[model samples]
Target chain A: MNYKTVLTVCPYCGCGCGMYLPVLDGQLGQPIPDKTHPLSEGRLCIKGWAASEHVVSPDRLTQPLVRTGDDLKQATWDEALDLVASRLMTLRDRHGPDSLAFLCSAKCTNEENYLLQKFARTTVGTNNVDHCARL
Target chain B: MNLPQEVLTEETRQIVSRLLRDNQVVGVIGLRTEHNHTGPHLFTSADDLKELTLEPRYPLATICQAILSSLSQGKLGVIVRGCDERALIEMAKLTNIEMERLVLIGLSCSEELARQCRCRRPYPSHIDVGEIVEGVSPLEDTQVRRLLEQNVEERLAFWQQEFARCIKCYGCRNICPVCICTECVLKEECWVERGQIPPELQFHLIRAYHIADKCVGCGACVAACPMEIPMTTFYTLVQEKLRELFDYEPGLDTKQKSPITTTLEETPLREL
Candidate 1:
């Protein structure tokens, strides 16, 4: 008896097609193309139809995990970030900054990616940074 | 293709019963014999077993979605053809149906039915009951390419004439295996423009462009279309173009993501 469509932009690519995530009974239904959007104008490829999936996907990682003794155990944010920083510093010290490479993710927010690149270049002092979307 | 009166083999029946008993699935959605015409139906209770039929008409997708939506979180079994399998995959991508909870009982269409549907692969790679056979080659429809070869003006005129018959029943969108949007743009007043003849050139163009890579070439749109519009040709062209550009095929591998979504590094086809 309850249904609503929440408008949002697709995150799959830089195309940024506008879409509506239909929520019925508090469950996500499907992505509805935004007829009025300028970029796509009510058109979506297969990815747009599936844009709402990652929001509530079962496969989505809810928390960060750190590998320990051949197994991954969930760790608090502070613990995980500290561990990452220490290991990265140790690698940078021994193997030099160029030894570490940064791989950009499509899943990260634009701001987050910018911050990551900034951290990699200014903090880590390495130009060995590449994007997953070079294609 | 002539549909059988009743086509469920004993093994299929047993599997269906076992799934219903074993899994928390509420029912099995498949064809049913009603008034001598097979149509899609949902069989939840065991007593409704006699009503299950897998012949003539195939409406498993519609029936399964309806049943799944009506019920709370639970499982359901569905009879799937190549088209149904593709529809289910696309639906799962859109979150319209949960693929994990749902059980698939694949059924290969008869060679004649496969031919009639212009099916590329009439059988599922994995099957539970039906015998596997190579799919009939899709009949060639050169009309779209022929239109493409025309000048823009001629192409416009041709499509104008073709789309003129569209009553805007949204049948093509409704029957499309990949068109899962609850609110379609074709129905919107601004995009398609309500109560217009020869619906603006953008109508068909936009819809075709939208489903270009996603279309599985099911021909359901053409079949549901009362106007007999050659939608398959457009989708086939789109499919071919997608393969050429991205080297991706829909529904063949459920594990692999669509090339469009994957990054260049992750996409094997992009290396080419």
Candidate 2:
């Protein structure tokens, strides 16, 4: 009997369209545009409307996986991060910093993206910084 | 029929309050005004009646479907306008809603709102509170008339230019109350190629034909579209054609099967 809409921002892109996710009996429902939102003005792109699909999708990843031979096996966060750091260092040492490229996502926050580019430029010493939203 | 807006609102509130007090329904689903904003709300008690405000409309029928599906027992009340009531009837026909376990509180639309939507029927079957205003014919709209006047080539060119701005946003389909398919053909790569912006014209044509017998003229698709494509005008034309060909108008009677979905025996084609 409990039904309410939770006003939140769309997680798909940087447009930050305001949307309302209907919650019925603690389950997330479809997304609807927030009419009162000054920026979006009651309009949403395709991604914004389907933003809640991944939250309940069965294919969504919940844990990190490390590739071994051909298959990927579940691993702890500590193990995954250590593996990434070591592989990155080895690649940097073997190849020039210019060979390394950093690709950021619109799903990440501004601060997270900034830190990623900073790490690429300062720590790895690479100018190959790219973003998914560059298009 | 010429009552002031405030008087209608007050009358609606009193009726809802009475329904809540008498336990006619466990809850009344309507729009609740809060902080100068309004959204769909489920009023469980009479105390919340003061916040009930009806002005800017939302797809209340969709919310009603959500609530009714999840509700295990007891009947639920919903405030429905013409479009909402029509949508509910269509949903019931499709077995998406249990019409028996629900009560409809009809609310008539204002003439201005009716004209804005270009709705053919602005009021529900029965008006509980608000005045019943005249329905606006879709042909009265200049855009619809102009589009109708265009030849086949001109119409194709016009739609091509308009659909070019489409971002492939499914807002129109998502907001439609009668579009209750769990697996949509629009998402299929076979029907519509993946990663193609401004999807093939078949994308729009498929959707148009699918909902031809079910469209309730809610104008939600037009409002939800980011590109502001004149979808209502296009659907209204389809509706007009259906009327002329079969004398079939959807959402008017739940028992009457859509001419497209039925066999010749069930719903015979009208003489041209």
Candidate 3:
């Protein structure tokens, strides 16, 4: 009996198409386009329609995994971050900072992307920073 | 031109409150305004009737099907426009919804809304509220007329250009109320090649043929397309052909099987 649709924006891209995610008994349903939205006007791409799938998908990554002996094992955040930092430092020291490239995602906030590029340029000393949405 | 917005809302609220108070329905499905945002809601009690406001229509029939399948018993009342009613009828025929457990509260559309959609039948069969306005003809739409006037080569060229803009989003298929296939052929690699933008003409052709007999002309597909493709123009042409060949219209009755799905004896072709 508890059925309602929650209005939200699509998280897939910058279009920020308004959509509604129907919730029945607390279970999220498919996305429906918002007719009154000025930008999309009830239109959605495939990504918008399937935006909710990732939230409940079993295949979604929940924790960091580190490769050890050709097998990936779950690791704590600290462990994963330390490993990544050490590897990047080692690679930069030996191969040079330009050898490593930083790729950011559209899903990240503007601030987060700015921090990443800043880290790549200042900390990592590499100018090879790109974003998935750059195209 | 039409009933004032407040008058329509008040009348609809009164009917919904009565239904909830009398226990005629467990919940009434309608658009509700909350925090200055409107979306579908299941109002189980009359206390929330004040929030009910109708505008910027959604595919309520699809939502109804989802709710009915979850609930074991209880009659559900839904505020339906002409397109919702047609979608429900089509869904009932496809075994996606149970018509017996539904109480239809028909709300006729305004002439302006009908004209915007180029709707052929803007009013439901039974009008519970609002004035019944004249339906707009799709032939009057310049886009539909442009397609109709084109010859085979010109039509192909036009569609090729349109289809080229397609990002293979599948929004058209996903938003369709009648497309209830659990295993869609559009996903199969054998039918539609994967990882290809501007999918082959077969992708559109297969979908057109699949829904040719069942389309209710709700314009949901057109509304869901991000590329602004005029899908209704193509589907309207197919619907006209179906009417010419079989003398049948979809979403009019639950008992009328699609002429394409039925045997020749059951649904004979009309004399050309």
Candidate 4:
């Protein structure tokens, strides 16, 4: 019965169009463009309007996975993060920091992106940062 | 979208069924499909009311205007959401619809449905059916405000970038509830040249000015746009300007007159 609209910037591109992700009883209903949005002004591109599609998508990943031998197995956050951290450290130490590339995601928040880049540049000492929407 | 809410369907059905069986109006117009698919249907019999649905869609009042124009005389019943009711009021003031002959069966949309449409006023001012839910706050349009804040050159550049994506399908004009003209200026070569991909800025400007007074803020144009042009923001700006200038809000009350049609003596123009 509870319904709320969480205002967010579109993650598809740098355009940063504003949209409302409708949450109805805890389920993502649809994405609606914000009319008063300074940038987009209530108009949505195909991607912005269909942004909610991935939320409830059956094929969407529900858990973190780590590759084990040939097949990947679901693992807890601590286990996954530890494995990733150790693997990335080994790659950086052996093949140089530039061998590892850090990719930022549009799905991630601004703070998260900042943290990712800082982790890559300062911690891993790599400047190879990229974005999925680059294309 | 056409599927009735599992909780409210029975109550809504009973109301529609009674309205049809009692012959309150010659026909009751409502949605007849479900599951993100729907179209307006005019129910002439109580049996047809069985198919009546409350889909999260349908531009019923606009279709009703089209129907009303062809008919000489007939009382019509329409299932109206907040925007539909407002649009009908705007149309009636323009003489496009006969308000007196129409019976409105108002329905308050669920908050979830309201949020989906980005509706400011999801429920009609008056309701004849459905549980009354409080209206949610509509998101503000910073784009329009930013455009208004910009210098002429900056505004022009902004528009150039925005309209660059226009496939010029005229979905915004076609889907707009307020855009009921015998001959729209947008179609005219003098205003918008044929086969123009990113149409001349005048094309949008003309349409924007035309619906300024009448736009009910329905976001149908936005949804219909294949290119996903943010047409509603333009109309939203227009409506806001109309409100500020004339202190007249469209589709709020049937008795209220549209300043655009009224003489200056009746509704004096606001000072610039």
Candidate 5:
């Protein structure tokens, strides 16, 4: 009785298919396809249907990690980002920028992705930038 | 707004309101609006019955099945299309639902919808609303026919090309009403082999055989497939074969059992 559907685009792919995230009393329900959306037209791939799985998954990572010695220790965003930046700079300076590779996430925004490629090509001076979207 | 379809819908609303007030059912499962999109919803009180609708068809049986399984008690009603009623009947036969605790409010589809579904029997045998119209003759599955017509080598090549487009999303299995098992064979590495795109032919054939006798021809599998692989044609072909061999039609009568499940004494293949 307290059910609701939030219309949104699929977060997994660059296809931007519309879907409805059904919420039952605040819990995630199945994702139904957006019928009127021109791209999806009430059709969903397997990923679209199971989009709710990751949200409530107990195995979802809650924090970033930093390797102290052998084990990965939970760390704050600042600690993690600093570690990554310092490591990237050291790795780039030790062996030219060509040795450093940048990987972009499809889950991030276009602006965020733009920042990634720019960082790699300008700051890192590396053409070894890649995206998760194979196509 | 006194058009025939509108009048029937009004009657349905009145019936639902009365049912709620009379305590005939604790909840009514039907299509509802949320964020401007209409899909399956459970109307618990007569006050929320206004949200019920008949447009933008959905597989209400799936919703019904989900709710029924979650509940240990309580009777429920459904504003069902012919296809929905048929699906419920099939579910009842499979023991997936308790027929005694469920209410069926059958609604006949319009001529246009019948054409869209290419349905042979567009109207439910029972009626709670909407006038029964003529059922359309089933549209020929030209794709399936053409495949069957080819020589062995050509058939192999044709299916290879078709299956090659499969992203192996398994949308067909997820949306199928008959597929209620928790452990599906297609998911096992031993049976299907994971990490491979365009799943092996054994994958699809396994599913086709599983739902051959149980499919209600609701076309949800075809509608949900992202690659638009005509999944319905495969199931429809199998249904046609069942009709030819044993004269068994699923979702018709509760008394009639599937050919595969029935004993020879109860449902003989041929008359003496």
Candidate 6:
């Protein structure tokens, strides 16, 4: 019988609403907006209310896959990364760095996105870096 | 769309009986079928078990208030949905119902019904007897979003055209679980003015503001509105914005308090 609430900040946006993750048997119960928190004042939007749904979602991806003969086949981490690097390098050589673009994710930490942008600029030689959050 | 009437399982019946047998709730409030038409009704000790129908259609919150007001002393148990829970939670905040005395038996809505309601969370978090399932997050309304993208004048004009269909039946207020005041501000001659068609945009604005923190997104207001104004979409947007700004979801937890009741200093913006 696991029962505990971990106070964590909502990562959807910069608002950083305070909420509690109710842990039950290693599975997370729905988020309860922290009433004592400074920002939310005990009200959550649809995203905040349903924040926990994604964590346990069966559709959530767990492994890397590459398109192989119309079907995506699971690939080892090194193979996947090597394929990506080789493709990116080929594209940059063929179409120039200005033609290549990179998209970041809200799911990743800010430092991760910063590193991705740095890799795009210094390694890939492209300035066209952006984030899905911009949408 | 008509609700699924035949889906009531035997487990639900037993649960209802067990609840009534155990607690002295004023009554179990839910929809019932009588004279071949279904509507909200209260189930009492004397009422036949056969009369308890969970399907067809019902304004559950309205029936709940009636039960609460008529018999103020006894604790009441309600079979609530996500929206009903939100309304009840907001009502609890306003002191409309005694929280300690009340017991809530939540019933989760199905995915198909949830999608129709554009509900982000279709089920209540704390349920006495029901299987928990994942709910779908609804897509934002295109019409409302398009209207919002327009300038102030266009938006005002659009609302003016929509509100013009109002018959002033007060069905929206009468059916709302959150609009619990005996004397409503919208009815006052000073605030809303008498003999006004559409009740002015300000009237709607005031109504929206009054329930800003409390609107449970039950769509009861929309369902009750004979005029069929897209009130749910508006309320949903406002509710979403509130959650975005504050990160609060209503009715899931009884111990939690709304941000509106507290001073801003106590609940500062997270980014700030």
Q: How do the candidates score on chain B by TM-score?
A: 0.84, 0.96, 0.96, 0.85, 0.90, 0.86
**Most TM-score-accurate candidate:** 3
Off by over 4 Å in 1: A1-135, B1-11, B139-157, B261-272
Worst 10 residues of 4 chain B by lDDT: B32-41
DockQ, per model, reads 0.01, 0.54, 0.60, 0.01, 0.36, 0.01
For residues B214-269, write the lDDT of model 2, one tens digit per residue: 99999888888889998998899999998888888889878888999889788777
Query: Which of candidates 4 and 6 reaches a greater lDDT?
Result: 4
lDDT of 5 at B31: 71
Residues B1-272, candidate 3: write the lDDT tens digits.
Answer: 79898999999999998898899998999998777667788889888889998887878999999999887878999999998999899999988899999998999998889999888899899999899999988888887788788899999999999988989989999889888888999999999998999899999999988889888888888888889888988888888888889998899999988988889898888888
- For candidate 6 chain A, the 10 contiguous residues with the lowest summed lDDT are A34-43
* Candidate 2 residue pairs that clash: none
Docking class of 1: incorrect
Model 5, stretches more than 4 Å misplaced?
A1-5, A23-29, A76-104, A110-131, B1-12, B34-36, B45-51, B139-160
Report residue B216 deviation for candidate 4 (angstroms).
0.2
Candidate 4's residue-wise lDDT over A16-133, tens digit each?
8776665544777456555556676556665676677887899899889889899989999999999988999999899999999989987787899999999999999989999776
On lDDT, the candidate that comes out on top is 3
Q: What lDDT, from 0 to 1, does candidate 4 have?
A: 0.73
How close to the true structure is residue B7 of candidate 5, measured as C-alpha lDDT? Answer: 73
lDDT of 1 by residue, B1-272 (tens): 42353554555667778878876566676655444433445555566567566654343465466556766766777778777888777667667777776788888777777766666778765687667666754434356557657897986677678888776656567556677676778767889786676677788887886677678777767755557777786676667666777888786755657777777778655444
Candidate order by lDDT, decreasing, is 3, 2, 5, 4, 1, 6
- Candidate 5 — which pairs collide? none
- Candidate 4, which segments miss by more than 4 Å at Cα? A1-135, B1-4, B34-36, B72-74, B136-153, B260-272
Off by over 4 Å in 3: A85-102, A114-129, B46-48
**lDDT tens digits by residue: candidate 5, B196-268:** 8888888888987788888888888878887877777667777877877788888998777888987867776
* CAPRI class of candidate 2: medium
